[model samples]
Target: MLGGKSVLITGAGTGIGAAAARVFCREGAAVTLVARREKELAGLTAELTGAGHRAQYVLADVRQRADVARAVAAATEAFGGLDAAFNNAGLAAMPGPMHLVDDETYDSVMDTNVRGVWHCLQYEIAAMLEGGGGAIVNNSSTAGLVATVAGSPYIAAKHAVIGLTKAAANEYGSRGIRVNAIATGATRTGMLGEYLDQDPGREPAMAGKAMVGRLAAPHEIAEAAAWLCSDRSSYITGATVPVDGGRTAR
Candidate 1:
């Protein structure tokens, strides 16, 4: 677990990112939370600080490189250095065949899910190297490993995340940096609301197929992410640990 370290998380206002913020703070890491919504980021910062954990919020869009640079600099100013980060900002658009997906939709998803991660890792790793090295966990998904009911665009972006994690871990491991990913299954969060609304029956049907026979809680994914960010996972890098309810077991 974290102790006296500084951690940064993208899309940290709600759902899994917010849950991970709570976990990291509990583990003793001063957390810098970032999200597109200034309102939600401010609210989360107030809540964490009120609970006596060191937390700060930066308002920026993850898809923009300049904004990401500002966010990382803000973290260094606030905490002196960064020890870890979770590149968790992403989008899940509706399901559609590859040919049917529009250019705008494709670019938007890639901009946030793939390019956003690229910016975060580039800046965060630079900061970590200056501070002697650290750990990183990117939020991938079960969709990255296997085809889901989602569109081909999302799957492609997520698969790219896994590739990035492996590449970064291999390149930086010797330098004391550890990079990994979490592939999560049917965790109930805002990301699922649209699909659930389209067909309520589909959500539970997918949940039943999981080895655990239930939807994973967001905190469950957060816990796995926290472990990856901590010294406890010192031997774990260049790997994608599933936070799924054993959905990948079969």
Candidate 2:
């Protein structure tokens, strides 16, 4: 559905971001993969290019506006213009009770989750405006919509993501830029695997929270994001579409 589109995917080194990179390329987008890890980004880029997909990698930390601007420029320069972006770069909150969460942990989560998206929106919007229009999908979490079993900083940062989604959507919808966020549920990402490995018994309890009785695959979340970034979701903007398996419905 994204035929010939120029798409940028942040956090493209692993998990849902990596999944989105593959899915977007399969759907015919020329993807620019952005992440902090050069090894992962290089390997993924090579894989896509080897498969005859137009792909490139930019090593960047989204918290820095200069890095974000350079990444945006790379996409537009490589593909001629920007068409869509999946701002999926983010950090998981460090596990701890609210009262015990240290300032360092809180700042890290907020800077990566909230400020990262802010940086992306500013640069991506400028690129889109110049190119006439585009679509953007920010990766918020189910934590964004309601409190969950997460650190306070994570919950707050996610809520900020949804708020930013609404604000950006409202400001740019008239300009042909559609901004939306995905309320992602528990997914079987590498990070989760590590947690589960430490306490295998915790899996069931985590799965039980979702009506589906299981965790989501990275691709499942990626599919939702891909659709949002495509013309298929043309009328969708300023909304938080839940990709959770009824976790919030309860």
Candidate 3:
């Protein structure tokens, strides 16, 4: 539980980010939501506040360092300081063979997925240090842990995320900042929906890849993140906790 804690969440307009916002609020944290979609952030903010949860929104594109800095400043200014963060902003890389992938696709995916976290880590770590300590959960994927048919660029970027997570944890763990990552399973988010649409009958096969025989719900992944960012997981850091429904069990 995160009672009275101040939390910041990237990509908070939808999917796991939005779900995390709700879960954190229900657990009593004042959450700051960040994303490029102003309308979605505004709407989610209103929904959280209306439900009697403390929440706010900042419009930002995580790929932009200035945008991320402003969002981080806004969160600290609003809540006094950040106690936790969920760096969940990401993009679904365009699926293609390595030989056929274009530079544009590579840049878009790497910039948003890799560089975006780099930008977030700088500001979030600084803020957490000032607050004496904090927890951070970066959203990696099952692809990060193993090879997948999803696009080489995506796999490479996610693998970079895990490396970043571990390195940060090793560097800051003693300083009271905990950094970890979650290797998520296929989930019913808009991105996955689009992927499934490409092959109308792909959903079941996708689910079958997991031992649980199902794709994860966004909230289920959110719960894992919340725990990672809470005292309940104080001993966890520099680790890639799998929320993949046993997808990587074998």
Candidate 4:
């Protein structure tokens, strides 16, 4: 569905972001992967390129505006123009009592999850504008829609992501840019593994929250993002689609 598109994927080093790189390439997009870990980024880039996919990796921390700017430029220069982007770079703070959350933890979560998206939007939108138009998918969480067992900082950051998505979508829709978000549910990513490792018993509890009674596979979430970035979802904008296995439905 994304054939001939030039796509940018933040957090492309692992989890849903890495899955997105594969999915987007399979659907025929030239993908630019961005993340902080050079090892993961380079490995994924090599894997994709070896498979004959149009893919490249850029070492970047989405929290830095200059880094995001470079990532955008790389995409446009490599693939002709930016046609779509998946703003998936985010930080997940471990769950804890609200009052016990320290300032450092709060700042870190907010900066990575919220400010990261902010920086990405600013650059991605500009690149898309120059290319005449594009689609964008921000990776929010079920926490963004409703409170869960996540830490207070994570909840707040995800909420802000949805707000940014709506604001950007409303502002840019008429200009041919479409911005939307996915309210992701529990998934089997490294982040979740870390959370579960803290308390093995929590695994089933997390999975049980979903009506499907299982955590989502990374590719499942990536598939939703891919759809949103394609022309198939042309009429969709400023909307938060829940890919949460009915967790929010309850």
Candidate 5:
């Protein structure tokens, strides 16, 4: 799908982001993994390298514009130029009523989930523009399309991601840039596992929301993301693809 392409993936230490890195490499792309955890990034990099895939890792938090810029530059330096990017760094703030949420919780969630994507978009667009054009897939959520049980801040930030994706695609499609987003459902990620731990019933409850009657594996989401970054999805842009197992169908 992405043969010989240079790809950058953020939040790549684990979950959907990490899974996307492997998928992109398996499809013949050289991938650069970015995350806040150096240890995790190193371990994933070693694993990917051991598998005989061209892979590298950059330790950086997407919440910081400089860090995001550095990560993009590192990817370009490693692979010559960037052909694609998966902006997947995000966090779900504590779930509760809007009134119950405090300022700190709201700020933390918005800064990482909203501002983080904003930073990644800015640098990724710049890099892609230099190379002529590129593909980008932002990781939004089902909450982005509709109301969910997640915290108010998380829903708001995710909604903003879709907006940004559409705006970028509209602005750059004529220039050969395709920008899109995935509205993901509840997936089997470390964060989801922690959420399930807090309320064991929450797992089944979320799964029930999807028509598939089960939660998605991170790789499932990664596959769709990879396709979006590939030429196969060339005509697709300025849209939010739903990878929610029909959760939004209802």
Candidate 6:
């Protein structure tokens, strides 16, 4: 779907980000992977290139605007231009009740989950505009539509992601940029291993929430995201496509 397009993916060191990195490569896009961990990012980059895919890595903590700006510049310099971006960097805070959630928890979650995307958008949009516009997909969650099994911080941050996506879409779609979000179901990824470890018994209940009776795989969500970033979805914008395996069906 991507052909020779260049794409950037935040949090591309692991989980959904890594999965999407591979998927985009298979679809013929040169992918720029961004994350804080040098070892993980380098390892994934090597793996992709070893497989004959165009991939490279940049070290950046998306919570910081300067870091994100440098990462964007690195991607543009390496790929010539950015044709798309998956603003998917995020954090999963300790699960707890609203009243039980402390200020620190709220700040940390919002810094990475919300502000991270804000920083990414500012830079990626600039890069896209320079390249004559592109596409973006923020990693929203089912929590954005309602409550999460997590905390208020997660829900609030994801809701902000959706808001940002729609606002950007409305502002830039006319100028050839497409911005959208994915309300995703629980996925079997390293990010969710904690919950799975802490309460193995809750698995059935979590799966039951979706009509499909299972969590989505990271690659599944990647496909939905890649489609949105492709020319195939040219006419679509300002929309939240759900990849929740029917978690939001009810």
Each prediction's whole-model lDDT (CA)? 0.91, 0.94, 0.94, 0.95, 0.94, 0.91
Quote the RMSD, in angstroms, for model 4.
Answer: 0.8
Give lDDT tens digits, candidate 1, residues 23-82. 999999999999988887898899999999999999989999999999999999999999
Q: List the residue pairs that clash in candidate 1.
A: none
Q: After superposition, how far is residue 89 of candidate 6 from its true place, in Å?
A: 0.8
- Tell me the TM-score of each prediction against the true structure: 0.98, 0.98, 0.99, 0.98, 0.98, 0.98
Q: Rate residue 10 of model 3 by lDDT.
A: 97
Give the runs in model 6 whose Cα sits over 4 Å from its true position.
none
| lDDT of candidate 2 over 164-229, digit per residue (tens) | 999999999999999999999989887667777778787888899999999999999999999999
For candidate 4, report its TM-score: 0.98
Candidate 3 lDDT at 167 equals 93
Model 2 segments more than 4 A misplaced: none
Query: What are the C-alpha RMSDs, in order, of all predicted structures?
Result: 0.9, 0.8, 0.7, 0.8, 0.8, 0.9
Q: Kindly indicate the candidate among 4 and 5 with the higher lDDT.
A: 4
Pitting candidate 4 against candidate 6, the one with the higher lDDT is 4
For candidate 4, the lDDT comes to 0.95
Backbone atom clashes (below 3 Å) for every candidate: 0, 0, 0, 0, 0, 0
44, model 4: CA deviation in Å?
0.9
User: TM-score of predicted model 1?
Assistant: 0.98
How much is 93 displaced in model 6, in angstroms? 1.6
- How high a TM-score does candidate 3 get? 0.99
Candidate 6 lDDT at 146 equals 83
lDDT for 129 in candidate 6 is 90
> Which segments of model 1 are wrong by more than 4 Å?
none
Tens-digit per-residue lDDT, 1-250, candidate 3:
9998999999999899999999999999999999999988999999999999999999899999999999999989999999999999999875577999999999999999999999999999999999999999999999999987578999999999999999999999999999999999999998788888889779999899999999999999999999999999999999999999999997
